[model samples]
Structures are given as structure tokens and as C-alpha cells.
Target: MHVVAIYNNKGGEGKSTVTVGIAEFLAANRNKKVLVVDLDAQASSSCALLGRQSLNAAIREGRTVVDLAAQLKQTRRPSIDPEQFLVWRAASEARGSALESMAMLVPDGDRMYDVESSMVWGKHNHLFRDWLKPKLTEFDFVLIDLPANVTKSAMVCVNGLAMSDFVLIPTRSTHISLNGLPRTFSLIDQVRNVNGDGFPTVLGFLLNATDKRNQQYRSIVRPMVAASTDGEIPPFFQNHWPASPALEAATDEDRDARTLKERFGNAYDHARKVARELEVACEKYERTQVQPIKLSLWQRLGLA
Candidate 1:
């Protein structure tokens, strides 16, 4: 299975939207068996796959990503039984496209017990990897939607990245969000150093919610793109997701392809293009056996 983590340190950078969109594209278009793990506390990705109202009620009952992970770890497998931590979202269609849904699979009866022991003694606290190993062959892709900021919840994402083949960083053209990229990169490097192998490659940095009309967008993004080629920064996604009001509206109505095409215009086309690029990157990284570069303490502190 190919694990892909869609992450960004800054919120409102369209991380969840891009994560869901890519998973939907892969599942419906490429006929790939995709599993989307919602690691965000807000459960936006879960809500998007399920429904806002249904997720709202789930949250009210304190059902969240943490609970789900804990339960799975405790059982040392995907939970098979339904509980507060497990929710099976019925697959729904929008614009003739089917949304990817999740079924909670608890492997054993000791859902809580296994997770606790793993945290205390397992290597790298990677209980998620141990739980997912048995089921990975069942899917072509596993997409994880991470929390906005680097926190304990975010570490789970890093653990996921350690198993992933690629990592996609989604961000807007704003300075603050863009500035967070280095730190995110540092975290990925840390995971790579710890794992010693199977570290996810930086597939590409995706520019989301970009405004073509804004002069600042060009000014900032142009330099960033140049920096990538100049070796000052890593390469980014060639296809950018421009701001589209229609996308938000379509998502609200749960309209799939037709709505996405109408709202996003050429954005989806670009997304596919970028996804292809990511595939190429993954192949190259695997073939070359590239190792992640470590950063100094000052570099990680964002002061370098």
C-alpha cells in the first residue's frame, strides 16, 4: 500500500479539502481501493466523507480520531465491532463520482489494552503501522488527513508518514502559512532519521486557494518556484489550485464530479497532473533509495 499524508502546519490552507479530493479521485477514477484516515481532531475529513450533521453528533458524544486510534491500537488490529470510536460512513455519490468511506475494523477484543502497551514499549510508538500492516494489501492507497498544527495528534501523522511513500504539503500563498513549510519538512526528516528506511518523500508542495489576480501571489509564488529549481527549496506541485467559490458550494451540496468541474474549472485537471508528478517522484525515490537530509537544531527551531 502507498501511504500519503496531506499535512500543513497552518490551518485553513485547504489540507483536508485536498486530501479528500485526491482520495476521491484515486478511488473513483483510478479504481484504486483507497482508505482515508482522519487524524484531525475537528474530523473535517470524516465529516466530508460522512456528513456534517452526522459528524457533529459524533463529536458531541466525544467520538474523535484519537479515540479511534486508541481503540485500534488496543485491539492490535482494525476494529470489527461498532463502538463510539468506530463509524461506518455509507458511500455516497456526487456528480456521478463515489466518495470513499471508512469501516472501523477492530482486530481483537483488547482495543484499549494493546494501544497502551504499544505506547510504552513499541518501537517509535508506531502502533498505527503495526495495526495497518495486515490490512495494507487490501488497498492501493491509504490517505491520512493530519491536524493543522504539530501536536501529539500530528505525531501520529508523522508515524504514518514514516510508512508512506509520499508526503503532500498543502498551503496557501500567504507568508505565515508558507513560512511553516520548513518546519513541516523538518518533522518529516525526523521521522526518516528514526525509521532508517521507508521514509516518505516530499512529493510536492501544493499551492491551494491561490488567487491568480493577486500581484502578491505571483510575487511570492514565483520566487518559491524559482527557489525550488535553484535548490534553495524543494520542488513544488506544478499545478496550482486557484481560488474557487464554486468548490466550497459544491462540497456543501455534496456534488461530486460535475460540481467539482464547474466550481474548480481546470483545478481538477491540474490536480491530476500533480498527482501524476507525485507518482513519478515516488518511483524515483524508491529506485534511488534517497535518504532524507537532517537539519540542525537552529534550522528546526526556524531561526536558521
Candidate 2:
């Protein structure tokens, strides 16, 4: 399975929206089996994918990421019964397209926010890699919608990023969002530099809530992103998500749309177009492997 993380340091940058859109496009249009991992304590993606009522039901029924994490913490062992957390008929689970596919692992921000972080992040930070990497072999694609803050609620999501084959950075054209990219890039570098370990390739930036008429996006943001196309930094996607109520409303469940076209309305075309481009980018990333990190102090000391 191709594991992709839709991530950004700052919130309200359309991370969840982009995640659900691409996930739906892949599952509904491309016939790919998908699993959406909601890694936020707020559980926004969960509500978006399954609706608030359904998410509450899942939480009450002990079928959330909190329950799964609790299972491991109580036993003092790391394990993953993905089924326990898997939500059936998620946003991507198009009707009659696939079997019990396109499931979601809803987060428990209330219970798991600071609750699980302090307990699980021991010396070994491979909380997700240790378990999730193996179980992920079951799907065609695993997409993680990570929370905005890393340390507060979900450091485990870092391991998710660590195990990902591709990292999808969804950003707005604003300076606030663009300013945070340096730190994000630094974090990715630090992780990848560990004993020359393999890391996910940035699958290019997906511009969200863009206005074609804006000179900032057309002249400044677009040019900056194009210039960022070094070997390590990813280029921007050709298609962008337009700012529209229809696109935002698509995040709301019970839209009752049968296909990607019906759901995203006018933006459906660009959404599908971006999804196809992402598929190709991931394929290219798979072919071009990341270079190993040079030995660190630990590796030199025979510790790593």
C-alpha cells in the first residue's frame, strides 16, 4: 500500500479537505482500496468522513484510535488491531465500488490529546512504525490526516509520517502558511537523517483555497513554489483547489453525492485532476529512492 500523509504545521490550511477529496477520488474513481487515518485529537477528519453523530457512536463503542492506544498502554505493549479502530463506509467508501474497504481510524483528541502522548512516547519513538507498517500491507493506499500540533496531542502521528512513502503538504497561498514550511522541512530532514534511514518524499504542494485572480498567488506564491523545485523540495501541483462553498461543504457528510463529480460540484474536475497527478508523483517517488543518511553519532557508536 502507498502510505501518504496530508500534513501541515498550521491548521485551517485545508489538510483534511484535501485528504478526503483525494481519498474519495482514488477509491471512487480509481477503484483503489483506501484507509484514512485521522491523527488529530480534535477528530475533525473523523467527523468529516463519518459525520459527528457517527464519530460519537464510534467513540462510545470503543472503536476509535483512543481505544486501540489504550489497549496497548494498559498491556505495556505496542500492538495494532486496525479492525478495532476501522470505521466502515468512510468518506472514500463509495457504494458498490469495493468491499469492506476505505475504513478510518478516528482519533480521540479529548481523551488522547495529552493523555496518550506522555504514556507512549518512551525512548523508542517508533510507536506507529513498529505496528502500523506491517498492518498497512492490507490496503492499496493509507492516507493520514495529521493534526496541526505535533507534541500536544499526537506525537505518534510522527511515526506515521516516518513510515509514509509520500508526504503530501497541503498549504494555502498565505504568507503565514508559507512561513512555516522551513520548520516543516527541517523536521523532515532531521527524521530522514537518522542513520541514513528512509523517509517519505514530498509529493509536491497542493494549493488550497486559491484565487486565480489574486496577484499574490499568480505572481508571488506560484513563482516561489516553482523556484523551490530542487531535488529534495517538491514542486507544486498543476491543479489547485478553488475557494468555494461547494468545496467546503463537500467536507460535510450526508452530502448524498454518488460520485466525486456530484460531491465537489465545479471543483470536482480539478480535484480529480490533482488526484491523478498525485498518483503519478507517488509513482515517480517510488521509483526514485531516497539516499541513506550518513552515519550519526549513535550509528558511529554502534547504538543505532
Candidate 3:
């Protein structure tokens, strides 16, 4: 499976929206089986995919990431049932029966905060990675909606990056969001230094909520992102998500399921284009065989 982490260090950068959009497009249009692991304590992706009522049900039934982490904290072995944790047909997108293959690991922010606070990273890191890998083998793509404040939830963020094949940074076309790219890159570098070859390579930035009329996006934010990377422009997707009422409205989910066309409306084309770019980006990494971290027998047996 191609494990992709939709991440940005700064909040309100449309990470969850991008995660749900790309995941739905892949599963609904590209005929790919997707598993969205909601790593954000906010659980925004979980709610967007399953709707609020379903997400609340999952949280109540202990079918959240918090449950998985709490279980892992008490066990050295993979005792938790992965299938039980997954919510099938999670996206509720009525498109060609492909969304039927989509699933998610819902999250509860309140419980997640407690779990993160209690987590002993050194002890749980590899165990969490080993446990999650096998559960995700059935998927074509595993998209993790990572938390914004990585410092506040360092344990989960570190292991999430460790398990990912690519890290796709989603940023808004603004000063605050674009300026945070350097810090995000620094954190990725630190993770690479810690995990070495196992760390995920940057999959480039997906500029969200772009306004074609605004030249500032091109004139200002573009240069800022380039400067952050030491004068070399980062790989930005050619197709950006345009600012639109339809796109903004699509981010909010209700009890009703909607087709991609119905939900995204005119912004459907924008989503499709960005999703296509994402697919093309993954192909290069796959050909190069950017391997995710695999547990050795010693590590699996808790010897390493």
C-alpha cells in the first residue's frame, strides 16, 4: 500500500479537507481501496468521512485511534483486531460503488489527548508501527490526516511519518501558512535523522484554497515557499484547489451521503485534477521503491 500522510504543522491549512478529498477521489474515481487513518486529535477527517453521527458512534464504541493506542500501551503483542477498528464504507460517497472499498480509523480528540500524554514514545513507537503496517496491507493507499501541532502530539506524529511512504504537505496561499514550511521541513529532517532510511520523502505541497484572481499567491506565497527551501522551489502540484463557495461548503458533512459531483459541485474538476497530480507524484516514489519501515524479526519479537 502507498501510505501517504496529509500534513502541515500549522492549523487551518485544509489538511483534513485535502485528506478527505484525495481519499474520496482515489477510491471513488481511481478504483483504489483507501484507508484513512485519522491521526489528528481534532478528528476532523473522521467526521468529514463518516459524518458526525457515525463518528460519534464509533467513538462511543471504542473504535477510534485512541482505543488502538490505549490497547497498544497495555500489550506488547498485536492483540487488537484491526478489522474491528475499521469503519467500512466510511466516506459515504455514492460513486460507482468504489467508495464501498473506502474505510477509516475514526479518532476522538478528548481521548486522544489523554493517550498522547500517557504515551511512552520509546516503548510504543515500533510496536505502533508494526501493528499498523499489517492492518494496512489490504489498501492501495493509506492516507493519514496528521495533527497540526506536532509538538503537542509528538509520539503519534513521529510514528505516523515513520510509517508513511510519502508526506504530502497541504498549505494555504497565505503568509502564516506558507511561512510555517521551514519548521515543517525541519521536523521532517529531525524525523529522518532519527529513523534514517525509513523516513518518508516529501511528496511536495498541495496549495489549497487558491484564488486565481489573487496574484499574491504567485507573487508572494510562491517565493516564500521557495525561500524556505533555501532558494530551491519545492515540488508544488500544478493543479491547486481554487477558492470557491462550493469547495468550502463541501468540507462540511451532514447525515446525508452525497455523490462526488453533488458534494464538490463545480469544484469537482479541481479535486480531480489535484488527485491526478497526487497519483502521478506517487508513481515516481513507487518506481524508486521508497521503502517504508519494516519490522525485523528481532524488532517484531520485541528484542530490538
Clashes of 2: 2
Q: Write model 3 residue lDDT over 1-304, tens digit each, in one string.
A: 7888888888888888899889888988887888898888777777777778888888889888788877877775767778888887644435543344578988787777787777755555555567877767888889999887786246766677767878899888876666676667666666665565645777878888887468868675655445436524346777899878777776677624467776677988999889878988888766342223222422432223
What is the TM-score (0 to 1) of candidate 1?
0.74
| TM-scores of all predicted structures | 0.74, 0.84, 0.86
Off by over 4 Å in 2: 73-79, 90-101, 120-122, 194-196, 230-232, 287-304
Kindly give the stretch of ten consecutive residues in candidate 3 with the minimal lDDT sum: 289-298
Q: What is the lDDT of residue 162 in candidate 3?
A: 67
* Candidate 3, residue 183: how far the Cα is off, in Å: 1.6
Model 1 residue 158 CA deviation in Å: 3.7
lDDT of 3 at 213: 63
Q: Superposing all C-alpha atoms, what RMSD in Å does each candidate have to the true structure?
A: 5.5, 6.3, 7.9
Give candidate 1 misplaced runs (Cα > 4 Å): 53-68, 71-124, 152-155, 212-214, 250-267, 287-304
- Top-down lDDT ranking: 3, 2, 1
Per-model C-alpha lDDT, please? Answer: 0.60, 0.71, 0.74
